[model samples]
Target: MNIQLNQLIPIPLKEKILQGSSDIWNNNVVISKGDYLKIVAPSGTGKTTLTHILWKLRTDYTGEVQYDGCNINGINAQVMASFRQQKLSVIFQDLRLFGHLTAIENIELSRIKSATPGVGAHEVLEMAETLGVSHILNQKANTCSYGEQQRVAIIRSLVQPFEILVMDEPFSHLDENNTLKAAGLIEKVCKQNNAGFVLMDLDEDSYFEYTHSLKL
Candidate 1:
């Protein structure tokens, strides 16, 4: 699948935020399948907001956001929801886990409305173990450390099938070694699935060999 943005600009930002080098805030771009892309910007730059818009969580932004050549804004809410469930997965900055539930339970609640087969609980546990958080899976999400919760969020996002995975500061809580581990896991899975990824971060450095980089 390919996402084409044609002069897509976030509204209410023309007067507030200063423009960047390529005018990405008000310009055009393409995110193709198998593309590994990064969005690097400082705080308050709408990195999270952009991801939300891509996944239909927000409608305040202006201009066209096309999914596989179809105008996303033209679709009804039901169809949009279906599109996200089947084709998009996201690791939100806030983690968005059910804090009262066990990590495994929280991970298991991922939307599996896609045509592809859903991941089993054992596979979810394996992903947690790979990220070094298997033991914590039985614990309540709120009781786990921030890093452990982040790993839980990663597992939750990965268990579903997707064409595009959006990560908003996904490794903010991890050290270099753990960050490398998480990135490697994402790379391996994305390659296997032939899915593209869009990662938003604070700096230019990235663990994956990115196909493209842009500033907000």
Candidate 2:
């Protein structure tokens, strides 16, 4: 599977929100399966916006993006939903965990039992433990700290079937150690499935030893 950014540039932004030119917005690109892509941009340069567009969460932009040959702009809601559930999983910047549910329940919600090549409860718990959140598994998501919630969201993303795993500043809440732990788990899972891993961050840190880097 591959995602093609065919002149896939967002519309122009005002000088206030963004200044100067951006390479991503001025070029076409392609990211294939198993590719590790790091999109590094400064704040207010639309890092989240690019991630949303790649995840098909927004369309208030210019150009066409083809996901494995299916034009993203043409897909209906049902198809898009299925695509998201089965082929793409995202760790949104907001974390988006269910506030009322316990951490384990929140992670389990991402599971589709009938979906083959999917992660199991064992793996979910394994990841939670790996990220140092196993002790909080019984706590409600809303009650957990932001860092804890971030780990919960990471585990949740792993429980689903996906060909491309997208992350939007998933490590923003973690320190260097936690970031390494989380990134390690993510890389392990992505390698096992040969899935593409795309992350958008504000700085060009030596994050993940990212195989490719794009500036926005």
Give per-candidate clash totals: 0, 0
Tens digits of per-residue lDDT, candidate 1, 1-216, equal 778877766675655544454335767888887889998978987888888878777778777889988988788888877766777788999999999999988877783446563466677767887899989888999999999999889888888877789899999999899898899888877886788899999998859899989887
Deviation in angstroms for 14 in model 1? 1.7
Model 2 poorest ten-residue lDDT run: 12-21
Clashing pairs in model 2? none
Top candidate when judged by lDDT against the true structure: 2
Residue-level lDDT tens digits of model 2 in 139-214: 9999999999998998888778888888899999998999999989988888877788889898887757678998
lDDT against the true structure, each candidate: 0.82, 0.83
Candidate 1 off by > 4 Å: 17-23, 111-115
